[model samples]
Target: MTGERARVIVVGAGIAGVACARELAAAGVPVQIRERARVVGGRMASKRFDGRPADIGAAYFTVSDPDFARVVEGWRAAGLAREWTDTFVAYGADGRRAVPGPMRWAAPGGLRSLVTELAAGLPVTVDRLVLGVEPGPSVDGTPCEAVVLAMPGPQAALLLDPALADATRAVQAQQWTSTLSAVLRFPHRRWPDFAGAFVNDHPVLTVLCDDGDRRGDGEPVLVAHTTAEFAGRHLLQPTAAAAGVEEAVRDLIALPEPADHVHVHRWTYAKPAAGLPEAYHLDDDGVGLAGDAFGEPRVQTAWLSGRDLGRALARRLTA
Candidate 1:
């Protein structure tokens, strides 16, 4: 490792962390991103399935805030994003209903592409698990000027230094349900009206999507997500539970039989019902906490929290 000390160390490479890093770097502050995962894009993510990029995290995010809309505009101009649809289908106890109006956007390659684009000019160190933070100096003896904990509140609490634990404890962390995402490729398309559906009150399935229709890729891919309750109950037995989920998805979408290929993914901290105190929380030592947990758990909230932290950090560094 280099003997040089970074002006700031941002933990986690999710949207919030990347945004904070980008904002800090743009302000001429030397920042380094340490991520536990092999690649960036904490939750707004994707992976290769059957030679095609499939989004297993956030299906698609909406641009509601003006500031976030500006960022989305930039992403669109850069060819990293495109409009998926303005209409959505909701599958509840009453059956499937088409709802039209709001504009929805998606990345051409996948959701992870957006995070990669945001981190283009930032220095990100992947596969570095930060067990905890120490007072005075880091384990390497590098006196970090500032530290940003940009992960779920519980995860952040685990890594907090003793000095900050009590204060941070007041910032209530809610219990969130998990999700199991199954990506399947089909020979022919199933749904007609919309690209996705919100299956309600089901035992195993929650959402199902026609990937081909959404991305205009012409390849039939079905992505099914398990409900939070179901995921938590069967997280350990994925292979055994996946068979039942596959069967449930087939029944929901009216598929003749099981899909061609099925991939199961488990997200321990999928969403947050409650959030931290503020958009950006700065400790007495100039350290900050930012992420989806800091604000609303939506994609826009994550971006907004990061932007807010970036602006705040820039002001602090300039002062």
Candidate 2:
């Protein structure tokens, strides 16, 4: 570790944190990112399953905000993102219905690659798990001018100190849903031809996506997410949780049991019940907060929240 570097420590290397650091760096403000994971891209993570990459976190993002659209355009031109689909099949009491909406965008190398691209030149210290914040607004006791908790509201609530009681109260009031994801690997693709399936009214399966198709590789892998209710019942025993999720996916899609074993990952804070209107929030202590939970819960909202916070912190630090 260098004795002298950026005085700002941004925790959580997810899309929001990385986007914040990128904007701060671009504004000529020194910033350092600390991520608990071995690599950046927190929720937008992609892992190799059975030899191929699978998106186990966020499936895809929607672009609508003009500013976010501008950023997406840059990523698209750089070959980081491609349009996945503008339609999805929703399964419910009325049976399957095609729902047309905004064009959902995906990345060629998995969604995580897009976050990595955003963090290109920023200084990030990975594998540094932060526990809590101190009165100095330090992240686990590393003194810094400011600290940015760019993660889920529930996770961030745990790190906030009493010094920011107001922020803590607000964050604690936020409720988040959890989901269990199973990566089912198959020798050959055998599911119906759809971009992704929204398993409505299903007790176990909530969403299922063809990983190969999402990545635009035509590889045979499926990622299925369990309903929050189902996940809450089995989050502790995630491995055992995979059994039900895999079975539900198979039954819903009318596919045979996966030839290979299914891989499971749990998201304790999958989505927020409500979002704040503000882009970024800060307190008198120089501690700040930003993420999808603070604004609209989506990839673009997360990025925008981070960008706004980074710029605000830059001004405060430089003042």
Candidate 3:
């Protein structure tokens, strides 16, 4: 598939990249996705522990946009995704209280499976690291009609050449924060009954998700995301922070038992500190940028950003 004559080359095989490629393909445009990782999914990542999948990246997603809701419906019908919960417990000065909000969705197979589902049959090449994107609007000196960077701005900035001023400036203006996610596997369930919680004003923790509840399997596993400050301190050696994270979780829920195993994952550019007003950026140089950074950091936002960029590129190329 990599040998095909792809007019457009999409860097990053995350949901945004795959969504863009899917739209371009549907519009009869030729595009290919190149990902640095062995598999796609980007921030919506997952890991397996004892044969059970746990969400290690994004805990869950909320639906607001009608178009995105339709997409969610498809996933629900296909049994790739399910409604996890609408209420989450928030911890702060007032203490823990149930906060009702939009319906947050989850996947029984883990959130990554949703991206994998969207990427099926797409011309995606894994382990294909992009070196640079130059003025010819080419990738690694190989020219294409356009290049779509569907990743964090920090990552995309690495590939943009100084000559591509528009793209370079757009990417440079983006600021992102880091995070460390830890998955703790215990012998049995011992935490509270909540499926998820938002940790506010904490120096160590940011969010916690009951992996068992979210996965709909009740496997006695918990996933914790640390604050940017905490993550920054241990970015160099994320595993070392696992002990602190586990302790925070235990204390937060008053658990007496310790986790049998813990695994930590580092996301250097976990999420955009803020987002641009536009859904995506397409410059005259034929270099486009798409990701959650284009809007709020949500699964729907990433998909919409990529989908919009693909449609725009298709129209431009077809014209």
Give the best candidate by lDDT. Answer: 3
Worst 10 residues of 1 by lDDT: 166-175
What do the candidate models score in CA lDDT, each in turn?
0.79, 0.85, 0.92
RMSD of 2: 1.7
Give the candidate number with the greatest TM-score: 3
- lDDT-wise, the better of 1 and 2 is 2
> TM-score for every candidate vs. truth?
0.93, 0.95, 0.98
Residue 98, candidate 2: Cα error in Å is 1.2
Residue-level lDDT for 236 in candidate 1: 85
Clashes of 3: 0
What pairs collide in candidate 2? none
The digit string of per-residue lDDT tens for model 1 on 1-319 reads: 2344677888889999999988888887888899999999998878897678988888888888988899899999998888888877887788878878668788878888999989987889899888876665352345677788787777777776667654266334545668888888766766465678878889888888777776678677877889888888877876666677888987876778567777788887888867655776776666677777765678888888887887788888878
The lDDT-based order of candidates, best leading, equals 3, 2, 1
lDDT of 2 by residue, 87-186 (tens): 8888888988898888999988888888888888788889988899887767777788888888887888788887778678767867799998888888
Candidate 1 overall lDDT versus native: 0.79
**Model 3 C-alpha lDDT per residue in residues 1-319, reported as the tens digit of each score:** 4456889999998889999999999988889899999989999999887788888898899899899899899999999999999999999888999999998999999999999999998998899989999888789988998999999988888888999999999998899999999999999897779989999999889999988889898889999999999999999999999899999999889999999999999999999999999999999999999999988999999999999999999999999
